[model samples]
Target chain A: MFQSTGEIIDGVAKITLKGELDAAASGQFKDTIEKMAEQNPKKVVMFMEELDFMASSGLRVLIFAKQKMGAGVDIHLIGCQEPVLNSLEMSGFHHSVYLQETYSEV
Target chain B: MEALQLPATLDALGPIRDYVSEASKKAGLERKAAYNLKLAIDEIATNVILHGYEEAGLSGEIKISFEMNDEKIVLVLEDRGKPYDSRRHEDPSEADLELPLEERAIGGLGIFLALKGVDGFDYQSENGNNRNVFSMNRPN
Candidate 1:
């Protein structure tokens, strides 16, 4: 199962992801990214501490968010588990976003 | 050896991954090895469901089986959806991996990572079935 919740505040968007993010869950994640993009947040942060698994589809959605939010917006992925971190690293997506143990505005 | 058969659909991914986890535990694989095995299986399984079955307008079942011996643990996934050879796809090269997000192509990334994540990966098409075998050496 996959669940995602998001909110935009102070020009920053925060989305919390839980459960597995597989092919079936990518649509939901994409939808959340789309909703968050509409608000034009300057920064996007995804809390992925509870995300147990992520398939290639999830990576695609991250790519989508980057393209949707454009190059100006910074995307931060915080508190990712090792498995998820492995996925990002294997696909070389770790370079595309900021990975942090905690999120603090610069 | 242990085996399971499930429908080739997105919904089966979670259960399929759970089965991998259990097999990894049973085989006493290290955490990183187990995670890599699961990721490898999940990627190919996703391809089988999405490209082999759904995109082809076909429906079938995926059979997953595993064998553990003194040297390694090998997992096999067989599906009748379509004949797919992941090796045929161009793997993302180091240069591709270095490309910026906007320039990177999403296609083939999954199969690339899937092949790279495992210690051994082989694909064979026989008797109208596509079989993907992933194996990892047991840490001594």
Candidate 2:
């Protein structure tokens, strides 16, 4: 399942995703993103500290959000697990988004 | 032409993975490549479990056969429950990843993932059964 929580703080939107990002959990991620987009936040920080696994479907949704939300918004992926990060790199998604090693400084 | 027979069940995922991983390793597949093979097979098994035997209610079995010849690994996954063709792979829009979570479609990613993870993926539906053959060469 996808556990997504979003909040707007200091004009920035922070969305945290945990658990497996599989077919079953993509819907929750999509809904949370739509709600966050409605606020028009300047930047989006996705804290992926607890994310264990991610399928291509989940990654595709991120690509979709980047386009729909426009280029004005920057999405930062922080603390993604190794498997998920490797997947992103293999798919050439690491270039399109910003990845931070740790969320503590974000 | 002895055939390797296995029960078609999610329990088969482990043994199936083990058999593949060992064969790939013996063929000098790199650590990364072996991992990819495992990951790819896991995704296939997951699909079979979720979609193939959805009606089995957690009681279905999947038969997997491993055939290694000439530096290549051919994994034949036979499922009697449903007809799934793995060769009909369509690359989902790379643009969809950016959609807000609720707007994305979940139907195609696993197959894509498995396809990307494996080397040669083929499928044949016959005798009211679905058979998929995933082949990968030994990494140099």
Candidate 3:
């Protein structure tokens, strides 16, 4: 199961993702990213504390988010769990995004 | 030993993961090992679904069988839609890992990680089906 919601706050797109992030859910995540990109937000922050699993398809979306948003827009990941963090690290995605222990820490 | 036959689609990934997780645990794999096994299976299954079925425009099924002994566990995935060998990619060098993200190839990274995470991997094609085998050491 998967659930995600997005909102713009102070010109930054904040998307909260929960549940397992398998291939089936990646399309929805990419759609959220596209929707957020349309707002031209200066930054995109993903809240992933509740995310339990992340498949390769989910990592692919992170790549898509980077390409779609361009270099100027920063992407922050907050509160990544061990499994999801391990997936990011395995694919070398940890180097491409900023990881925060908490939203306020960023 | 146990087996599963699922459609070659994204929706089947979750159930596959669940089955692998349960089987790995039953085989005496620790948390980390079980997690790696699940991740490895996900990578290969994603490849099968994307390259095998969707890209080939042929719907098919992926058959998975798991067997465990005192020392190790083996997983075999059989697919009929297309032929792809994940072992074709060479192990990444340190310099390769240092490359800028945009400069790196978009695909194969997942397979690379999956290969590194497991104890053994093999691929073969026979009778119009691609068979991928993965093995991991069982925790003492």
- Could you say which candidate leads in TM-score? 1
Question: lDDT per residue, candidate 3, B12-126, as tens digits?
Answer: 8888888898889789888878888888898899889988899999998998889888999999988997898888877667666665455555555678778878899999998
Q: Please, what are the lDDT tens digits per residue for candidate 2 over residues A8-105?
A: 89878899998766555677898888998898888889999998667665776786778667777888999887767887776656666888887654
> Candidates sorted by lDDT, descending order?
1, 3, 2
lDDT of 2 at B12: 57
List candidate 3 segments past 4 Å from native. B90-96, B99-105
TM-score of chain B of each: 0.94, 0.79, 0.91
Tens digit per residue, CA lDDT, model 1, A27-47 = 999999999999999999999
Which parts of model 1 have CA positions greater than 4 angstroms off? none
**Candidate 2: DockQ?**
0.14
Task: Supply the TM-score for candidate 3.
Answer: 0.92
Say which prediction, candidate 1 or candidate 2, comes out ahead on DockQ. Answer: 1
Best by lDDT: 1
RMSD of each: 1.3, 5.8, 2.0
| CA error at residue A103 for candidate 3, angstroms | 1.4
Cα RMSD for predicted model 2: 5.8
Kindly report the fnat of each predicted structure, to 2 decimals: 0.54, 0.10, 0.33
